[model samples]
Target: MVAPLKVGIAGLGTVGAEVVRLIEAQQSILSARCGRGIKVVAVTARNKSKKRGIDLRGIDWMKDPLAVATHPEVDCFVELMGGAGDPALSSISAALAAGKSVVTANKALVAKHGVKLATLAEKHGGALNYEAAVAGAVPVIKTIREGLSGTSINRVYGILNGTCNYILTRMEQEGLSFAECLKDAQRLGYAEAEPSFDVDGYDTAQKLAILASLAFGTKVNESAVSVEGISTIAAEDLRAAADLGYRIKLLGVAMRTKTGIEQRVHPTMVPLTSSIAQVMGVTNAVTIDGAGIAPITLVGPGAGGAATASAVLADVADVARNVRALPFAQPVAKLKTTTKAPMERHEGGYYIRLMARDLAGTAARIATRLAEQKISLESIVQKHPNGGLEPIDGTKKSSPVPVILITYATSEDAMRRALQAVQKDKVISGKPQVIRIEKN
Candidate 1:
């Protein structure tokens, strides 16, 4: 019989502790699947005395993450301690250099240093599996890496961040402001005390960089993505989107363009009928559009200890089965470098909400500016302050009117120029709210 696969886990936090519990609870199942038992031989955490509610009786407690990573009896090094640098990076590098397989859930680390780490794993002939890094338990990494290996991927986009999704969902359904929903998200433990990372779109950008690399055979470049947060998304915008037969979502989109690959994260207006629009709350979903096959969407819980630990264990099972795949789905040397596609040149439909000053010529001036830029409007709606439609030629009033305009496919440059001219003309009361329209 094959001997058991020895594992050493660094960081006994929620996810790390859950991984241990899972391995013990599912030993027979894991053994039956892998043809070998998976055993946790060592572990290390900051405060070992702190009760984690897990029985660590027979397992060895190492002094630090580095020690756990390079433990003599360990065959797989699992890094659950999150950070883009330091002990996590050093430990994973040491494990890979020692020809031991490694598994991790650190998206920041993978996004920033994935190519280099993949190079190390490739040269040392050890597997570098990080299925938990991208979409929690969604298995998107494996689907792009292995399942669609033969198909040509044209686009990969999704609702990658749970906090932003929850906020947007609540704002759409209940007409809550972004701030109110974000506050509730923190109280419910969905967002961090300092929530800028998740709220500002950096978290989704990091995850998108990794997905773009896997789907397009490019080097992981987080800076290539143009990120826009959900902080500026108002309840009015969500209401306008719903009226336009669309739902507002914080989406991470990566697609092949004529110039190159365009990756971006922003509050997008997806049609209410789209698969991604149906994904609400803290759940996650990813849609992959390949050349010939229909769009495949995978949906599941994107966060939490149980969901994340399930993905971490999937990587460990691959290691136990001695299955080694290139970390980014291609050789490090073969991965091409990618630059940030210019957002100004991006082409898409737009949803523009202008709080027009209650002046007689405001609407005429706005239309003239858009016409000058060759922007064709799909539709337009002007609403009074009391949520009633204002007559197109009604008498002017003192309060600013909400003018919502949906435009046909146009370049971002044209939209910006037109809006700028309208702003200079002082036809709008405040800055306009713009959300890009993403087609299914």
Candidate 2:
């Protein structure tokens, strides 16, 4: 039998501890499948004496994680110390520099510096695998990097943040406001105390950047993605979406456009019948649209110790079997420098909600503005908060009525200009709420 693959793990957090437990539990089967044993020879974490619920007996402990990565006995560096900077980046660099393979669950690290790391790994004849970085326990990365290697992928998108999904699902299901849902999420441990990263859509943006590169064969560009969070979503918006036969989901989408590749993370209105809309709660779903194949959607738990560990272990098993592939499914040099599609040029259907003055010709004036920009409306609805148009403030001519309009496919630039014109006409109150509509 071949010698076992020795792994050195850095950061024994929830996911890391679970990785160790999983390896120990599945040792016999993993070894038989890989034709060689996979063993945790060394481990490093913030606290040496911390209880991880896994027996760490007989394993070497390293005070410095960098030492584990550069250790002579360690063949693979499993980096769970997630950060875009510092010890994580430097240690991974050192590992690849020393010709050691690396497997990481660090999304920030991968999304920020994937190209450079992939270059380093290839130059040093080492492998770099990170299946847990994007959608946890979902094989979207592997499917795009390997399964769809021969296909021309058009669009790749999904609900990438579990915290945001959980909050949004709670809001829609319970008719709660965004603040209430977010509070419940934090209390239930679905969201962190400072949930800006996940709630503000930056987490999904980072993951989308990595996925976009793999799908479009472009260099990773995290800064190019246009991001919007679910924090601004209100119960009224959720009710409007339901009435329109749609569900509001924070989606990270990347696709080839006429001008360039478009990557964005925003609250999107998807048909309730769509598979992605069916994915609720903390679950996530990724849809791949490619040539010669129907759209494929993969849905599963996007995060958790057990689910994330499953992905990490899969990467480890690949390394154990000597599975080799380019870090981004293609040579670093061969990856194209794609143009960042401008948001103004984006063409899509939109759901526009506004507080319009309830008076004669108000709707007509709004329609005139859209017509001037050639923005065709599919439907227009005017409804009062109460059952009738009676003014709540005891005024007959100036009651603010809710106006909802769904427009046909139009350029974002045109939509913006039309909305601006409508605002100038003084027919709407406050900033209009606009959400893009996705057909799938």
Candidate 3:
């Protein structure tokens, strides 16, 4: 029998530890499938004296994390020590510069600096495989890289942050406010103590940048992806959306057109019956649209230590078997420099909620504002008064009533202006809240 492939791992954290477990549990199956056994030859972490829930006595321990990348006994390098810089970045560069394959589950490293690192790997004949970077266990990178290889993907996007999803779903379903839901999520360990990155849409934006590169042949542009969080999403708004047969979700959405690309992360109104709407709680779902082939949807646990580790091992196995593909599934030189499409050019539907003075002239004024901007109202459902009875109608000047409406297909720029006009009108009482709707 051929000897096993030697692998070294850095950061014996949740994912690193899971990698060890998976290798042991699926050793026989993986060996048969790949024609060689994969073994852990070395490992590293800050605390070398710590017990990592499993026996690490057999593997060589590295004092400096970079040593694992260049270990003489190890043929493959696995970077579970995250962060887009420092030991992880320096070590991976050294390994690739020395012409060795690498496997990593770091999305920030890829989304922020994939192009430079990928160029290095390709230059030195080293494979930088990172299937685990985008969404844990979703294999989205693989699907786009291989399955949709020939199609012209307009754009790719999805719910990439599990922590945010849990919070939003809680707010939408339980009537809990964003802060309340976020607090609960953190207590449950779904969200970090400092949850800004996940809750404020930055995490999703980073993941979308990676997906955007795969969907469109563009260099990953993390800064270009616009982001809006659910912090300001009112509970009353969630309840009002449910009444209009919609569910509120923090969506990382991108689209490409003749004009340019529209990348946004915000609170969106997904149709109640849509497959994405049903993806509640901490779960994640990604939708890919191609010009020719059928639209593909991949859904599963977006994150977890083991879930992410499984993906890292999948990439390692592919490398051990000598199977490889482009880092962004295309040559670095082939990736088009992205042209950030302005949000004004974005064409889509919207859910608009406005509070109006209780009078007959109010709705007409809103309709006039929308018409002025070429936006048509698809449906208008005047919210019943907060109490048991509906607000009594009065044609003459009277109190203000909350009006909720959904707009037909229109440019985002137009809708923003129309909604702005409605909010500013003398007949309206408060600012209008608008949520973009994804029909698919």
Note the residue pairs that clash in candidate 1: none
Q: Can you write out model 1's per-residue Cα lDDT over 1-440, one digit (the tens) per residue?
A: 99999999999999999999999999999999999999999999999899998999999999999998889999999999999999999999999999999999999999999998999999999999999998899999999999999999999999999999999999889989889999999999999999999999999999999999999999999999999999999998887787778999999999999999999999999999999999999999999999999999999999999999999999999999999889999899999999999999899999998888988788889989999999999887787567644445655767887888899999999999999999999989889999999998
RMSD of 2: 2.5
lDDT of candidate 1 at residue 56, scale 0 to 100: 95
lDDT tens digits, residues 1-440, model 2? Answer: 69999999999999999999999999999988999999899999999988878999999999888999998999999999899998999999999999999999999999889999999999998889998998999999899999899999999999999999988888988989898988999999999999999999999999999999999999998998998898888888888888889999999999989888999999999999999999999998999999889999999989999999999999999999999889999999999886557889999999998988877778888889999999999888765555222223323445787878999999999999999999989878999999999997
Between candidates 1 and 2, name the one with more favorable lDDT: 1
Models, CA RMSD each:
1.2, 2.5, 2.1
lDDT of 3 by residue, 1-440 (tens): 87888899998888899999899889999999999999998999999777778778799988877999999887789998889888889998888888888999988888878998899888988788888888898899888888788888975767788998898888877778888988899999999999999878998988888888888878999888888888888888888777777888888987877777778888888888877888888888898988976667789988999789878999989887888788888889998887556778777888876777765577788889989998877777666656222332443434666667787899988888887777777777767787888877
Model 2, 357: alpha-carbon shift in Å?
Answer: 0.4
Question: How does each model score on TM-score?
Answer: 0.98, 0.97, 0.95
- Runs in model 1 lying further than 4 Å from the true structure: 384-395
**Model 3's lDDT to the true fold?**
0.83
User: Local distance difference test, per candidate?
Assistant: 0.94, 0.91, 0.83
Best by TM-score: 1
